[model samples]
Target: MTPLGPLLLLGFISGHLTLTRSAKILTVVLVGGSHYLLFDEISHILHESGHNVSMLVQLGNPRIKGVNYTGRNNSYRVISWSANEEYISSFNSWFLEQQKSFFEGSESLSTFLKFMGHLALQCELILGDTSLMDSLTAEQFDIVLIDAFNPCSFLVAEKLRARFLAVHVSNFWSWYLAGLPSPISYVPAARSMLSDRMGFWERLKNSAMFLGSWLTERMLYSQFDHTIRKCFPPGSQPVLSELYLKAELSIYNTDFTLDFPRPLLPNVVYVGGLLSKPARPLPQDLEDIILTAGDEGFIVVTFGSMLASVNLPVVLEQINAAFSQLPQLVIWRHLHTHWPSGVLPAQNVKLVDWLPQNDLLGHPKTRLLVTHGGLNSLMEAVYHGVPVIGIPLFGDQFDNMVRAEAKGFGLTVQVNQLQALGNAMATVIEDKRYKASALTLSHIHRSHPFPPRQRLVQWVDHIVQHGGRHLRPFGLDQPWYQQYLLDIILFSLAIVSLAVYIVTHLLKFAVGYLCSGGKLKVA
Candidate 1:
């Protein structure tokens, strides 16, 4: 509506400022192996959206050029993290607490504090090594989104006064996030009790857990906050502190298709199926074998990427005994040596170091799935509507297997119990309910509220493009003392008020007594 010359100039300037600005540098801080699943999807999204992406993974894998390093395997990574004596000692103490944890519901206050202490220490060291320090020193990033487990990366963002978002690689409430979820339950990655959704009893248990867990984390943050302040001078500089104070957004790497009846946050975007997308093409030989299997039907056996290569000879024997009997040919993803030389490669069985998991699952003739119940594998099964026989080893596998079993799409049998393994597999393969249930679940999985990868990319790009002001965690901006809701302060005030009232009454009584010549009672 302005004058012609001025309006034209203003529009041109606006377009030039926005459209011609240099691309922003987005620094992504990934904390674990699973974090790859989340960032992998977001990476393509960000690049296409016109931002430069640099990744800082604590345990980097070479597959991603941005990742700085990779572990030889899970054991090697575990060893690397354990190299620190205090961390090793503390981890050992918490690691063995699994039995006690099962009885107590989830991690208790001491257990959680111990776990957090180890994680914070490990993250700090790992972050420094991953070139995250370089990004911070350069102050090059417009936004830093950290997978939440690595609180140290958050510390780094806070150091640089950059806007940050917390990325959760696992299920919601499965890891500790400050403020949200209420009362602060100790929901470790593998909570022994419920998923993010809580029932009446679960709510009660979590309420207690929240109180205890809150105290422990409070103590943990106290130590870490000091280190954070030291890391960035004038973290005291209110301007910088204000900018870095909160997480811009939280992204949940889950497809609503797979996770149901699970409570989630409005801010949380489920991008779970991101990992299920096509990556490298399946080898030709592998493709042929899978296509042939699809013709008559076959069962796929996988123990997930981490645990499959697990050197548990006993578990292998148990699985072998059961798979050898199915009507369908077995496609086994074996890690250690070729299916135990001469165990008789039955015409109905095929052995390989790996299989094109998604392709195979998507193939029509795939009949059954025998898994270790890792979340990624479990979700894949749901997406494909394949019946599952779960042999849970540890972590959330047990809970996942239990849920799958309860859902009627699968059955759970402990790896140690070979008989249970055989029986459960027989039931799922033969029973109609499991198959029907699997199909129904597949329908739900496919019918999720949105396209997972697209949503993930959308939200991720939103943060980078908008400069992160929209996604920051507003809760922590308030003081910790306020968050804790310190009743002690209230009690102290009440006591002072009561004391003044009593003292005033007593002085009046004394004055009246002296005037009337009555003695006061003294104890």
Candidate 2:
């Protein structure tokens, strides 16, 4: 055959072949964890959607260390770094110190900053690791999901050249960092114990606390910036303010029902119970205990993971004392296997190192929960329609309990008040309104337009498609003074000053003219 005939046959053979392309699956990297529960839930959801998700967590995190990560099909890969365990221990120790240590240290501001500094220091364990950073950069993640708690994650994301950044504040009321309105006139600080409704004097105190905390935190961020530059080889130093401003999406672990009505940016989403899942079947022994309680019901007590370090033997004693008189069986999730000689458990009280809290709260026999008012525990109680006796120690716990009280579903006792525990527990148990209110809130929470997980995923996808740049308000771009319109105030003051000066000068001139023209013509 001729050469032209052979070429035509080869073209016909090539036309029979088909070409195919698959959709690009986004790669998401989650860095930073002291609050792994929130991150874990989000990572799994993203992974299930066929996206590649990896988490770089601190080995020092007790929650992350305890969880089992090995399995078939595997939810997500967890990469961890072992920093100094002492850093974690010291941070925990600070929480357990007398509450006075927080308010009366060298300077309460400095003390608070130091605690934050310790957390920032932990980030160095990941940021300074050249090998890990190289591997992460090679993976070329599409986005970086960071716990708002660790501001240093900003550096990691920048170094990896990630396309987008999303921050999840595992707790509520993210201070001024989120660029959302948190008016001191009504909205309380994250750590504050004040309620949204306050008297004039109380509002003044709140304002002072707010201003002081905001200023101090700004100073703290400077220190964090220094650490970020020192730990990482720095060409481009990202200021903390820039990170907050550039954040494509920010999620707070707070619901409007629990939080005060404050103006929020479109970028901010409240997903309070995102970590919550349907209660799993309880252990056989624990199930037996609940079943035995019958109509009398049982009380669940837990101060969360930090309780093991809390030195408040007095608080434990009061809790025990109160349970002794109640008809309800008490299930106290005490971390220690043995109680001190001075600490005695009531006959009706069972002390276990851990409890399936969600399952326990959902049980028919769980009448009341005596909690430290941690957001996680409070949301669980609200989710299950259980009343609470809140003894908040610090951080957002106090504000959480205050919200519960305002909603009529719970009451708070002073952390150290031995006498008030009995009354608090009695009120929660005897009052029917508490249970009714809790049920109402539970219904409202369940009936929200979007479940927490769905809201989270929707926002993540929204940011991926839209880049979320429009969600950032113009207010964030303005300078601090301009954002508050201080210039307008200054201009108004200048105009008033000029008007007053002109009036005074005109009066002087009129008097001078009359005197000069011999107004003594009356003679």
Q: Write the per-residue lDDT of candidate 2 for residues 1-523, one digit (tens) a residue.
A: 8979989998877643311111122222332222665676667777775567777766554452112232225777776766666766776556446343421222245665766676577666667888988988887666678766667667667667675555554454565767887778888765567788899988988888887777766887776766767775666667777777677777788787666677778888888887556788888998888776778899998766545434345656766888898888899876554456678688999877777778889887888998878787888888888999887765556678889998889998875465788877888889899999999999988889999888876677666666777888888889989999999999999999999999999998788779878453433
| Whole-model Cα lDDT of every candidate shown, in order | 0.60, 0.71
Clashing pairs in 1: 60-69, 234-237, 247-472, 247-473, 248-471, 248-472, 254-272, 255-272
TM accuracy, model 2 = 0.85
- As a whole number from 0 to 100, the lDDT of residue 96 in candidate 2 is 46
- lDDT value for model 2: 0.71
Q: How displaced is residue 162 in candidate 2, in Å?
A: 2.4
Clash totals for all models, in order?
8, 0
Return the lDDT, model 1, position 48.
Answer: 57
Model 1 TM-score (2 dp) = 0.68
Query: TM-scores of the models, in the given order?
Result: 0.68, 0.85
Deviation in angstroms for 436 in model 1? Answer: 2.7
lDDT of candidate 1 over 123-226, digit per residue (tens): 45654444545635585667666666556656656556677777666655443463344433324223444555566777777677666644554575554554
